[model samples]
Target: MSQDYDKILKENIEALILPLADKLLGLSLGRLEEIPDDIQTTLERRPDFLKRVISSNSHESYILHLEFQVKDKAAMLNRMLLYYAMLKEKYGESIKQYVVFMGRRKPRMSTQLKEGMIDYRFSLVDIHQLDYRKLLDDATQPEQAVLAILSNFKKSEVDTILPEILRKLQALTNNERKLRRYVRQLEILSNLRDLQKETIKHTEAMPITYNIEDDIRYQQGIKYRKRQRRKYRGNY
Candidate 1:
């Protein structure tokens, strides 16, 4: 992943993580306390998110560990097991582990490992398999709104999808400066799905006003459009 992508993920994961925990994992979290992710053991390992959550209904509390996986690594199960051991030893509480797969391709990572009398597993959710509309509607923050693109929206045309995303983002954001930042985040994530150009095109058609000349991304997009015009003329 590019540094920009990593930066976006690190910054905006809080928006995506909680909702996924609630809707997918069925974690009826009443209280979610951020736990220190740095585990100091034989090997130092840091998880993406570690939280102590109390169930709203049952009043049960446990350690919830969620990893945002961009690639399908075969050793993911082993890695989770290691983190499981470290967290269990440190916290001495019930631990639930989940991996949120965000890659464009199908995930082939194993979620469970078993031995005689030893059973271990982690929940794996392919983000693309989720309904994008539901995810978008559930989004409370602009950061979360941008992530709806990463979810399952292939059933809908890109023509149809990008506008709604931008519109929802427009409704959620009041600050132009923050809106530009969120647009950049959306642009970067859209690249993963090969929809950056469409995202820009849809934004151009939308009514939201912003200084495109002031933004490097829009400027490059403008140049690309000009190039396309020249190419079409030359072809004719």
Candidate 2:
């Protein structure tokens, strides 16, 4: 994937994670109260999504750090360990971390660091292993509906599920700009499952009117193009 598209996907995923933190974390941590804007680390490294969540009973609170990885990278375990140390330095042992893998290939990353004295570990979740129908059933939030495209959907169900998700997205918003943004996100996410063609077909068929300039991703693309142009001129 292009670097620009990668950035946009990460940003969109981060945006969705914030609003749907409860639903996502509920998979492992049960009910939680997200502490907004409490994720800054001492080393200036920000996790993709971080929040101090309080249990529903209000008795326990812990920092939940989540990172989204498009593909397995070397030193990922070390990086996660660094995050664990930093978060632990600030929040003590009351921190739980998870890395959500969104790559197409099966994940081959290690989730633990067991050296002579270090035995740190974190949870690794493969999106493909998750049942996307659960997210689709969450009708209250359109973000979940959009994310369902990235989850585990059988090849046979693509035609049925993709169109239904697009329709739900369309019904969730009437504003052209927001609708376009959601459509773009849905399209990008669909790439993870190789359903981009189907996503585009359904999105283009929607009747929403939107200007390309209104899209932040589009504006970013324009800026990148201009920068490339300037660099090309400078080279000559």
Candidate 1 local lDDT, residue 41: 43
Q: Best by lDDT, which number?
A: 1
| Candidate with maximal TM-score | 1
lDDT of 1 by residue, 106-224 (tens): 89998888989879999898877767878888888888789888878773488887888888898899977778778878887887777888887776675656776756576668889
Cα RMSD for candidates in order: 7.0, 3.6
Model 2, residue 116: C-alpha shift (Å)? 0.7
TM-score of each: 0.81, 0.80
Deviation in Å, model 2, residue 76 alpha carbon: 1.7
Residue 215 Cα positional deviation in candidate 1, in Å, after optimal superposition? 5.9
Cα deviation at 198, candidate 2, in Å, is 2.3
Worst 10 residues of 2 by lDDT: 19-28
- Candidate 2 yields a Cα-based lDDT of 0.72
Candidate 2 displacement at residue 64 in angstroms: 0.9
